[model samples]
Target: MAVQSAPEKALETVGPPSAVEEGEDARVRKKKGTLQDRQDMWRIGREQELNRNFRFLSVLGFTAVLMCTWEAVMFGSQYGLLDGGAAGMIYTYIGAIVGFSAVILSMAEMASMAPTSGGQYHWVSEFAPPSCQKFLSYITGWVCVLGWHTGIAGCSYTVANMLIGILAINYPDSYVPQGWHGTLFVMAVASVAFIFNTFLAQKLPLIEGIILIVHCFGFFAILIPLWVLAPTSPPSKVFGSIEDRGGWGNNGLACLVGLVAPIYALIGPDSAVHMAEEIKDASRVLPLGMVWTLILNGTTGFVMLITYAFCLGDIDKLLEIETGFPFIQVFLNATNSVGAATGMTVIIMILQFCAAISNVATTSRQLYAFARDNGLPFSSFLAHVNPRYTVPLNALCTSLVIVCLLSLINIGSAVAFNAIMSLGVAALLSSYIISTCCLRLKRWRGEPLPPARWSLGRWSAAVETFAILFLLVVYVFSFFPLTRRVDAETMNWSVVIFSGVVLFALSYYFLYARKVYSGPVTRVKQLM
Candidate 1:
């Protein structure tokens, strides 16, 4: 062999880059370019405070677990059974999926336009008329915040109830479930979310990735046994039966009330959108995360709904189960083993707790974003990002406080707590409706929108219109009492709660925020 100089030897040792390596290098460069492009488009300065630690799969996992659709469908099946019965769940679920598709697609396109932790409020700022941008954006921010807070409470309640449900199943004779017991569990559940979101923040993406497996595996784990071991209803009963157990007096009204179950199961696909600032190539990846989560969760949730409907045994008996959870009875009936049902229920409880963790993460980021814009009462404090963990510790704490307070309502009355939970869905839908209307108005006026990497093309007009209209319809129905003979326990207080928040936001705006606060759009250098 010929003698070689030091430089020549080093080159030979390193070797040339392969095609695969070069391709990957190009992709990485493209990703950086996209991120920079998005930042420049948004024209905001504080993008670096939170870490971009999430990628596509992790984000998808975060949203999938956050939605926990199939599990929610089961948890919420009783209301559907009471009004719409087996066939009603099947049909309304189908309709809700179709209607919600428009809302998700519309929101997805806007997310691509401005992927930020502010979510609907951010979009409202960008898309609304300049004259009303400040007011609309501020109101949207508050409503969005209200929505997420209620969402945290709702998730914690689910975990708490499931835990108590397990205890009631195993120790029925001794465990006379007290309302305070569930409240204590709710506190514990909220604490878990706060700890993970604040202390283990770095591990969230990895945790979510792993939990995604459990999400799917648990689906099959509970599903296979139900299909194999449970008694099945005939096709006619499963597909065509409808009941008006709520005494709504008409099949149409009963079905409408039942639609709440499916809609609630599907509402939070935007969980990924609220984490946009913490995702690589967020403008593109965020929309994909939201869309795919919805598709996957919807498909699986629908399948599970059909399965549970068929295996429901006796609806009245399941409803009367001391655990206060119909799904526990379904699992028990299917497996015919207390241990087996406990195991399956534990999987659901675990995933729900996981969802609560993700909920806290998203809710904190959202509150932090609004506070950064001086939209909240304690704007500076709530916006603080912990220097050590690079997480919004203060925001997380605030969310925890609100969650605990909301859960405290459970001790007063389960019906009241449910009403608070229902407010979450209504508030979120209101935010959607406002943002979609703003986008549609801007489009009609021929104004330039922020360039969208994931545009809906010509379908944008039709999709946005349908989203607004469908959302409005759902919002109206969401406030109606399940039965016409409305009483304190049976009445839907969502509208009251929603109106109160809006009134508070409006009052606070004129009283304080209006003087110091501007919409997020005003912070955009390019727009200015």
Candidate 2:
């Protein structure tokens, strides 16, 4: 039950790191390095099993593509356009960038301190009150895992439907869209992600490096066409209009609801934090990768949003388009050529597919980390790293199966599948709220924190406080349906699904995990 505070004792005395070493001396040694010391301080049992193939640029690429903000803006613009219009989307997006900046900075500080693949849960384990650490950490792990799985589902859904959209665009009259079609594509996307994360895990850095080039260039490719070819809206409409088509009855509330798209686009900046062990100079590179990805993606996403606003053509017609996506309509309007629009649409699809691939990797790593600490069923199997590939093959397989099953929900009801996917937003924000709140409580009590290579220095208090307050507001609105009048079809059932996940996790804990699970903190109790 005791927690360890010193690193040297843990390294020297806690056996041989863990079962997941490259060789005898490649990872663990008598002489402690800074990375090892930090890992020891956090009681992370797993050695450096995954290759440290990711440098700053690759990490940045991974985070950027995972978020894929500009592409998300286009994919999700329908909600914003109907509820909040051009002015609303733009202003809310700018606010999101500002609000999430605080979040990114606070998380960067925590990543510097712990730098573990467990991310928010691991930080909660270390920073929460010692008497309550185990329960809180266990709950956070479940929430974090739920958030990640939902994220993969959401990204895969986007990628699959966009592929369908392309078909609809080309065969407008003959191709009848079916829910089963989307489900099949979703499964296909998940299968591809599994293959890449398993067999091609070592080549991720190089792959992401290439995608990063495409991520940047694709922005200009889409942007220049909109600027040159699309018909422009007046300044008043682009900057002053507020369309309240959602029947929210209040423009402000409608705009707030519309913020979901932009916020969802920015949700995964902590992505790099979950891949910390695979990143070289994790304490330093993790923070840099996270913060810079936010800044870089935010700038480009903002410009894209504004450009889309100007070139949006007709919101009402686009919303009812056959393809079921508004951005395709926008591109078609801009170029007046199906071939040109398909080319641009394909760019977004490719980036989103890439996001799905990285999302699978990140989610699997988190699952592996949680399992390593006995937080889930079959912990030992799920936590096993293939000694040859250095990848958690079992965890990756589990995640793939989960994704395929979740996709089945779409076949039954697209609305229900959407509700399930929405769980990611609420679940992730809950983890962020808990972790940042725990960090602030420690700081307020003047408790000593783990050494941070990327400290916020004098501004840490303000940043953490703002992050909590802002995330709480977003969390509440995230569960609000786009309309005031809700039916089973229109309901935002994410809150309901999230509660179900919470209930299941708590029941599992009390029934089984309470006895078996010790939380990650106890692993370092000997060093204290």
Candidate 3:
């Protein structure tokens, strides 16, 4: 159960260096002077053994549900993920839940075999043939990072928006914003979460557990009130046929357009696998967490949406809010008391914070893991560990900084921030698609799958193939602006996904990947 130290100890003990070799040896070893003496390397083994009491399984499920708990129940039901401004996204969410649900089933199996810090990138490296490993893993890392960052930034601003909504409901004329006000609030909230994560990644599982309890229990907080205020709707209206939106011409296609909105809610469910090195018994805990997390989220989110729709009966009225946050309007009407609506707003804000916290853990650890493997730009420095905390302190701090900078974008344009957040979902879903396709390809090639605690067995290939198609379909839709409106403003999400790739490639070929960075490094390199 003990992990071995870094592999550089061999070079350290060499006799006072007088003999020096030049060429190839110098490229891998950085120290100035003396011949690059022969260094011993350790074969890969299960070394980053984390503490293991089934912690991840207990926490991860709740993390996923807490994120969408508010969104699905309050918003999706009214708009049906419609794609109209924020209101229409109700339909988009339904599609995402269905799509991601398929993808996670596939990923849960993959997680058992290659549970590590690298996640999609590492899994691709191990399962892929040597020739394609480098390129595929690199692409996956970029996509994954984009997705994680989007999820984090989305959570931060979503939290801010929720807080602002709370302010509006509580105080008259609290519209306060030169745009910078919301930005400042977003940054402050994000900073607080960032600081907490940097200081407390180790305790995240426990914090997530507490959040989970509130996340699930908080549904009743609203459900109880809405049920009392408005009991029932015509069954036909609630679940019968798709209500008309626009341009769709048919309800069937409108459903397709709706998929783009909720894609993010279904993301980060498997994020626990990114922290495979941190979870104890990750092979077991992580997989269970990934699967059950979806189950918990899917069930609650579905029930919550149905209940809200049954109670809400009026889509037109819900969409009539002056601020365009229909969920707030729902509270204002449902309670008829601004004070009670303010209380519900507080609950929603708590949920947003919980989402941010979950992402901080998953995202920072994944970045740390990728860097540990020499896949990121300052990998050597980023892969460092704080011996006292036994945490990837450097990498965590770097991730915090990156997200903090991303928060500023909110100041200039919430639309831009929302668009980037959308693009991130595309990139993320793309990574999942690629990862699942890898699984399908391996089966076709008759490659032997690694043994793991959780797997889909006979259904594995089919499940993965289904997931790939699901994500591909949803990702394709991401390019279209909802409301049939295309500008720099809305659903520009796909643009950033493309931009993130172009940006990463530019740097990879010219800067880091070529000059200082290389391939598949380990903590072993740092030991030197």
Candidate 4:
């Protein structure tokens, strides 16, 4: 994005002068802090926030829409199912049920209430006990930053690697870059995702729309091959019985590690809700988007999952296929159609391009919301919105830069890159848990923050409770070290990720966060 227009007189230095007064008052109020507590609750449709400018239904639908097929491709392939380590378990019915329960219960309400880009931190500041507000919210923001950015990095890497796999499978002799190929490809892909969003931010929905159509159309296109050519295979032979694969016991922890497959695949469905303010009837539409995405992607993904399982004649052969994607082999087996498989592969690539484009918007909105209130360190730069485009140029660029640096990590340490992505899960899960815990606490105490036009009603409390417990379990499991000895070929990336999250959180506490970093530039809402 072009540099934002020069703010007239440094944008009036953002926060109102009264912030100083409020800061002083906050200190005095805390001195007399009681369990009764006090909250700086602001009205929902305040001057600082532009209530709802965009069409809510469109934006909400768009957010959750594409997630339907995105993960189907991921989980339907070997990477998420076979190699994503944690996701393998997640693709299973039991694991998906657990994840579904968590998302519906916990994240749904939090997204409705806090709806800000800073996500966890913005939420923490408004809700946490007055005394611990600074530390808790700040940590939540930092951790969430890790989760959001690392999630982007992970997708970039995953897509890059998949593209490379396409090349290695099709053109074995082609001169692909060595050792650092992934890093280079990651850079290139990030550039594409960034350019589409930055220069063309306004047209994003159109592009997103096109992507959605293609995703749906492509699913149909590929189904023809599975039905026509692969009809001979049946569930009895192809999909292994629980007894055949040693069910859950023999797989042991390896199965648990596979949870990442579904987790990664189902990720970003909530992206639509993040753009709540941009949509027309956001309250009505956001939840609808979630349901739409869930149904669409859920149905397609399950079909692919079960079909692929049924079609596979040999699990070992599927695993040993030289090309990283074993599903191509499934197509080859079912239809004896490399040509069709190749076609499907191309379709997926196109859809992935679409997914990447959507991701840029996702990251931008997040950065914009965060910087709007000066949540990040470089508030002055990141908070600037391009007057012409009405987009947050600095935040967009910052996101791009983060992804580029993350890509470089693939060259220096592949394990580090993987670990970062793993930690991302923990980061996101933490945000979900904290937000729901806050909601429950708030409800229990009868505190009135702004209510959403759309709400879950009495079930809100129960949903949040279930979500909190589920996320806690998921968080603990995310940190559980992968068993590298089970497969020495791949490094145990979990330890590095778990440790990195700790360092980032602790470092924030040690450095700038101690004194500065007032939770979400509430004083400067107009600037955002």
Query: Number of the top candidate by lDDT?
Result: 2
Encode model 2's per-residue lDDT on 57-79: one tens digit a residue.
Answer: 99999999999999888888877
What is the full ranking by lDDT, best candidate first?
Answer: 2, 1, 3, 4
| TM-scores vs. true structure, each candidate | 0.92, 0.93, 0.83, 0.80
Q: Cα RMSD for candidate 2? A: 3.3
lDDT of 2 at 172: 85
Clashing pairs in 2: none
Answer with 2 or 3, whichever has the higher TM-score. Answer: 2
Error of 1 at 197 (Å): 0.6
Best by TM-score: 2
lDDT of 4 by residue, 84-200 (tens): 322243345346555665575355555555454455666666676667666777667666666777766766665665666666656767745454877887778778878877677
State the C-alpha lDDT per candidate: 0.83, 0.84, 0.62, 0.57
Tens-digit per-residue lDDT, 393-447, candidate 1: 9999999998888777745344755576678888898899999999999999998
Give the C-alpha miss distance for residue 241 in model 3, angstroms.
5.2
Stretches off by above 4 angstroms in model 4 are 1-57, 65-91, 173-177, 231-233, 237-240, 243-249, 411-421, 480-489, 521-528
Error of 3 at 365 (Å): 0.7
